[model samples]
Target: MSNNHGFARIYEQGDQVNYGRSNVANEERHHTRNAEGYRPKDQNKAMNQMLEENIQDDVAERYKHDPTYRATMHGNEPSKGAKIDAEIQREEEELLRRKQEKTDSLPGKKQ
Candidate 1:
């Protein structure tokens, strides 16, 4: 229910009966004709700041306790994934080194 008066009111005050109160129920839409599109920003600034602080604190607390969340935030892959990548890169380099040695061992004066 809207508590604002004059142009500030968004909903009209009224009374209704539920199924328990009566057999028939009534419904009405409360859209104020003079309601403005914008509201004062300072009205909820303190409340919003507090909520944001609480959320940041919660995230910080979770970062200390949640391994999965920390890993996800740091990178999209696990530590084991990095190790696997390193192994694959090492294998590739070793293969290239062997190929170079074989090429060096080959005896050819002209192509």
Candidate 2:
């Protein structure tokens, strides 16, 4: 076998030697962007931002002061009794609303 600089193979018996240099590339671009440890400093600001868009500003402020309501809002503190009470209250309110809507929809109720 002729030992040519380009044509000559490095390994004598095994598969052809494929050589390319690998460097330690910086992984900064592959990192996930997120708020690692960010939390709102102001309680009111945090609450307002987390609240639903349809939630009234005054009602959200009032809810902030209620301990039971707050506990139920966040899952941190469990309130089984409060949850049951809320469910019952919601059903009652929903029934009342449906009744009012049905009454209003009637032709003789109000024009």
Candidate 3:
């Protein structure tokens, strides 16, 4: 006669447990930090020149046939535009004064 407790045995080889081990697990450390080194002075100057050349080329391409560009490149905007410009400049000056006052009131700054 077999005595069954209706529970499976704890330590059969097929049911053995390996702690902290997984058959399909991947171990990867996914974080890193890296530094970009400085460029030599001559190379830095050459890079700046190349960037300026590209910017000039792009501007020339964009304004090649634009009438507003032709008009403004020579002198002032039309009368209505000039009035709008004056209002914008006034607002800009008011903002600049407020910013200056705020900074002047800070701890080390003098008003």
Candidate 4:
């Protein structure tokens, strides 16, 4: 029968039909349904802490292996904190310049 064939087709394609809608269903099944709408405080804390630890370890490893990074960290070769401060100042100035350029590129701005 035609109706029987349609039901069989639906049964065969059920998994594919539900695949695209499974993410929200999976999240609802796995996560707590919080009505308060507030984010879980410690949800991202562990990830952020792990990332920070990894970054520190990488920086330490770089300082050990790379001469330029060692100099920046230890303030050994380029006159201590002055070089670091100058580098930060230069970066800030560069960022400001880029921002100004973006603003200038916008329409209806009188140069």
Candidate 5:
């Protein structure tokens, strides 16, 4: 068997690799290039926008149908509710961190 370098054997001995021609079709090239001065379209952005719209629709429907939920979610109450939710989330995260620390301190576990 012949010892092969990283180069493709299909090319003749003196054939030059054409760096200029990407071989990507014009249509594909257009799709790959983002517009000048603009960021590339994020795959996750579309999904996130759809998710946000769905969540907003769900929340609006709930506000229309449920008196208690609507009352709690409105202006001043929402702020209070958000504060409580944030506090609860922080406490839960702290508890999780403590548990992780305890587990990490255990014998036979690598830190």
Candidate 6:
């Protein structure tokens, strides 16, 4: 039975869930490149870059002023001994990898 006002019909239809992307067109759009396989110069690039620069400038300004926030992220800076140990381990690992790698030809750069 259908209601004359169509409110019941709308509620009945809404009960059946129409799930995600199953009905969408199976195609991708190349926003950057045109059909001619050439990238058209984006007018928004400069504007976006300037906005990003402004955001970075704001972040740096905040970071410079907010010592507590900086300390919270890093959680108490490591001691000089710990820093030196970490650096030595990293350099040792890098040297070992270079020496072991067969593909990478260091030639005269090898120690």
Most TM-score-accurate candidate: 2
Best by lDDT: 4
Q: How should the candidates be ordered by TM-score, best one leading?
A: 2, 1, 5, 4, 3, 6
Candidate 5 lDDT tens digits, 3-110: 354334223565523322232232234344322223223322323333445578889887664445665665445556655665776788899999999999999997
- Model 1: how far residue 18 lies from native, Å: 28
lDDT string for model 2 (1-111, tens) is 554443223335643343321210111122232222234233222222333222555558747544357675675664787667667777888999999889989887756
When summed lDDT is taken over every stretch of 10 residues in candidate 5, the lowest stretch is 19-28
- Taking every candidate in turn, the Cα RMSD to the unseen true structure, in Å, is 21.9, 22.5, 28.4, 20.2, 20.5, 19.4
Which has the higher lDDT value, candidate number 2 or candidate number 3? 2
lDDT of 3 by residue, 6-64 (tens): 21322244442221212112111111211112234333333334445556776787465
Candidate 1 lDDT over 1-111, as tens digits, reads 644432222123542211221111111112222112223332233233334455778889977655456567776765776556657767888999999888887888234
Model 4 alpha-carbon drift over 4 Å, by segment: 1-39, 74-111
Query: Which window of ten consecutive residues has the lowest lDDT sum in model 4?
Result: 15-24
The per-model lDDT (C-alpha) reads 0.46, 0.46, 0.45, 0.51, 0.50, 0.45
TM-score for each model:
0.32, 0.36, 0.30, 0.31, 0.31, 0.27
Clashes of 2: 0
- In candidate 6, stretches whose alpha carbon ends up further than 4 angstroms from where it belongs are 1-41, 72-111
Alpha-carbon runs more than 4 Å astray in model 1 = 1-40, 81-111
Alpha-carbon error at 29 in model 3, in Å?
Answer: 33
Q: Which stretches of candidate 3 lie over 4 Å from their true place?
A: 1-39, 78-111
Clashes of each: 0, 0, 0, 0, 0, 0
